[model samples]
Target: MKIDARSTARTLAEIGKWRGVLLYGDDLGLIRERAAQCVRQIADSLDDPFRVALLDQEQHGRVEEEVGALSLIGGRRVVWVRDAQDALLPRVTSALAIDSDTVLVIEAPGLASRAKLRSALEAHPKIASIGCYPEEGRTLIASLSDLFRDASVAVDREALFWLSSVLGADRAAVRSEVEKLVLYAGEGGKLSLDDVQDCIGDSANATLDDATTAAMAGDRAVADIALERALADGLSPIALARACLSLMTRLQRVLDWMDEGKSRQEAIKLLKPPVFFKKMDSFTKALERWDGAGLRRACEAVQGFELACKQTGCPDLALSRRLIAQLCLGPRSFLR
Candidate 1:
């Protein structure tokens, strides 16, 4: 049967009752997490030699054999298949027919809706199918709030908003960062906006963001410092170039909104993946300094930097520096 999102938690906790489960989704992190929970439900340690049998695509042919075999330790066993593909459908379908207590947990990242394996699992009487997609917007905010609440940490609404806005494109990264916040807060600690920033906001992405924002605002010194700090943090030059390109692309969209007779605030609000609340003011200031034509020129210049950074043996750092210099001086300073 297909597990509803509302019942995923309850179902996961009672996973031992199911013969097999197909954990498939765009969020590989969530898929891995759910698979781990299932593994723990049936076996003591994730690495329990006798009870846990790990499998991959190459070894998937042995899934049915593994699922049918009893644990030498005299308890339930778990068969974990990682990075599963549709070709394993027949084996999984056949394995579900076994009357053993062992449970099968399959992790299939980026599984298609109509994929044979997915369809078979969802329709099977003894199997549960769960889709693990990334959380966003209010869902993301609520999850973050619950995570903090469960840890007995009191986080305010504004702090939650800031976190949801900047946390992740994947559940694993969000979980890792949340663990850091929990540790930083200690027992019964209250998390303020400053606390969250100090713990979760000190990331390489933040430094890159600082560089792009300062570069756009013509603060050459701050831009250079942030760029150097990001590089020191081990972010690749190609990553830095891409960050600049992404910001310029967003600014161009903001200009498009403004040209449509929208006010500056309205245009900024229209930006998808909305600007980080703390950086809103600086982003606004930078947007105000550019018109449509100039913003378009800046976007094209940043694109060129991105392309150059991708070339083999390119002096990516120097090219990135020159691009930032011109961006700080506005688009007319582009090198021929």
Candidate 2:
């Protein structure tokens, strides 16, 4: 049977008692967390400890042998096939057909409506396919409330929005941020925007924002400082490269929309995560300073730096520092 995102966790916990279960989702973190919980519960209930095998693409052949083995101590067994790809569908299907006390949990990527594996799982009564799409606005708010309630802290709606906007769609990051806020607030305390800014606010994000903002405003010194801080924070060279490329991409898109006569408000409205109203001015200035050609060149430079970091095997901190320095000194002709 298929389970919607809302009921997935509860359903998985309950279904684990059965002989077999198939858990698949797009989010690797959520999938592994839920699957591990289920497996632990099943192991606890068995008379003898079960063998847990984590199968991957390289270990596809081992599935058949593992599935065919009789429980050594005559208790429940579990085989976890993680990161399942299309190549293993036949083997997985065959293994699932075996009538045994062992539970096989196959975790795969997200599936479209017409996907064969999804169709097979949907058809199988013992199998369940769960979708773990990023939470929407209301869902995120609800999740935040639950997280705060569990931590014995209260978050005002405004603070929740601030957290959500800053963290975007990363559930794990949001949970961590909430924990940081709770710790900062201490016991029996309420969470506020300032509390969040003080504790959970990432220095890298702030520095990146500042650096981009300074670059937009033509303040090289301020931009340099911001980039330096970001590098000092142990940000990877590849990560910095990606961030710079991402900013350039956003700037280019904003420029394209502006060229088509779209107002900044309208363009922001159409963008994912919906750029905050306060950031609109900064975004506009960045877009003005870095047009399409400039953005493309920045992307190319970052890519080259990323390749160098990988090839040189430099420490992440050293690589990031060098890359940031290069970016600071690199030609701004791309912004032309």
Candidate 3:
């Protein structure tokens, strides 16, 4: 029998004591998680405890030999084969055929619908297969919400939208960020946009925003603070330099487009991934502070820093600090 990922929880709970199971998915995390659950289920069903073996690609042949040789201690034996590929499938199939009280659990990357392995597993009355995939649409949003709820944190709609937009590419990263947000918020607290900005926000991008905001308003103090924070975060000199260059480049482009009678929205649309609405104010301010010439000079300085990083044996943290100090002082400060 083949089961869908969403139905896995209930299916595991109700699964009969089958002789074998094959759990496969593209996502390794989900595959391992489900496999653990299945092992627990088998343990619960058996009167006497069973032995569990984890076989990887390299260990599959040896494990298959062991499976063929071993008998149930007092109950069923469970063997878990992970990272199963085409080369190991035949051995696994042969091992599964042995008429013993042993159960084989197999995990693989993925399988085609018409593949021989799929056909064999489907034909076997004693085998069950489960599929896991990346979550989508409502499932994705719901999972995010559940993470917040589990952490006892209340996530507003706007906050969820912001998070989903920024961190949705990797589910694991999203979960980590949500956990961080929850921890930052503490008990019985609501997560606000400011909290997100303060805790889990992209520091490099945040630094750029702060610097751009201050520079546009001609506030040297704020720009200096942002530069200092970026330095303290251990960003390499070359990385910081590149980021500064990119920020200035973007500001220049936005300014040029706006000057050509383009609306802010139109400029944003032309930008890849479209700038987040919250970042528009910072971009507007940055454009006011630096002209095309100044932005070009900043890019040039970034190239110089890249050379320094390559040539010097100095520790990366120290080099980064020195670079930020120089940038904070002014373009001329880089000369010293």
Candidate 4:
């Protein structure tokens, strides 16, 4: 059966009842984390030699043998296969038919939605197929807010917004950063935007943010300098293009909300992964300069920019700079 994200913890607690589980998604960190949780559910320790059998891409052929083997310690066993692929489907099917007490946990972090292995697992009555996609939008914001609340850390709303916008897509990385922030803050400590920035922000992301903000606000010199620094710091042209598209997407969303009768301030505030407070003035300026139709065109162009960056022998850096310049000059100039 397929497992919903919300019910994953509840389902994981009873994972032993399933013959096997297939964990797959874009979030490798989440897949690894959930796979560990499944192993812990069945064993005393992760490295327990007697109760847990660890297999990798090359050792997946041992899955059937491991799943059917009796635990020497007289408890249920767990056979974990990492980076699993469709080639192991037959072995997994054989293991499933063994009627053994052991549970097979397959970790395929990048499995396709319609892959035979994923489809088989999802359709099986005795197996669970759980996707570990990255959380975004309000769900991510809420999750980060809960993390801070649970840590007894008082974070300013804008600080939370910045953190979520920047790091919330990677579950493991965000959690690690949040732990660092919590330690930096100490128990019951308060975190302002500056505090969080000092604790968790890196130069590369900060440079990218500066570039996007400056470009949107029509500050070409600052945008060019920041973009140069970002590229010099080893950030890819594709990443820069994506960053611009993301900012434009957010701005377009705010415009959509305004069209729905919300005030501009209300619409901006309603943005998930809210705009950084420090960038509010520049963000507002960009908003004033672009309406729904212009933003729509800008978004389409930025997407094309990203595609161009991916082509072989394309002048990625030049295209990236040109895209930024065009954005700074406004859609009217580029559309011409």
Question: What 10-residue stretch in candidate 2 is worst by lDDT?
Answer: 164-173
* Best-fitting candidate, scored by lDDT: 4
Give lDDT tens digits, candidate 2, residues 268-335: 56665455454667666665556566667777867777666655355656655554554444446434
Candidate number of the best TM-score: 4
Task: Summarize candidate 4's per-residue lDDT along 114-202 as a digit string, tens digits.
Answer: 78899988999998889886665677777788788989999998787777666624467667778999999999999998898887756
Better of 1 and 3 by TM-score: 1
Cα lDDT tens digits, model 3, 93-195, are: 7777677666777777555555667667767777777776544334556778888887788977767655643442234445566778888888788987667
Q: What's the residue-level lDDT of 55 in candidate 2?
A: 75
Q: Where does model 1 exceed 4 Å of error?
A: 204-276, 281-336
**Cα misplacement distance, residue 254 of candidate 3 (Å):** 25
- Give the clashing pairs for model 4: none
Q: In model 2, what is the error at residue 166, expressed in angstroms?
A: 1.2
Q: Which stretches of candidate 3 lie over 4 Å from their true place?
A: 40-50, 65-77, 99-103, 150-153, 185-190, 203-336
Worst 10-residue lDDT window for candidate 3 reads 164-173
Q: Which residue pairs overlap in candidate 1's backbone? A: none
Off by over 4 Å in 4: 146-158, 186-194, 201-249, 260-263, 285-336
Q: Model 3 compared with the native: what TM-score?
A: 0.51
Q: Tell me how far the alpha carbon of residue 106 in candidate 3 is from the true structure, in angstroms, after superposition.
A: 2.3
Predicted candidate 3: what Cα RMSD to the true structure?
11.1
Candidate no. 2 TM-score: 0.58
| Per-residue C-alpha lDDT of model 1 across residues 1-336, encoded as one tens digit per residue | 999999998999999888989998767777888899899988967999899999987899998899899888799999999988789988887887777888999999867788898888898877889989767666777788878888898997777877865554367767878889999999799989888887775663445667878888788998898778766755455455555666777888888888889998898888766777777876887787766677777777777776676556888888878877888887567534
Model-by-model lDDT, in order? 0.79, 0.63, 0.61, 0.81
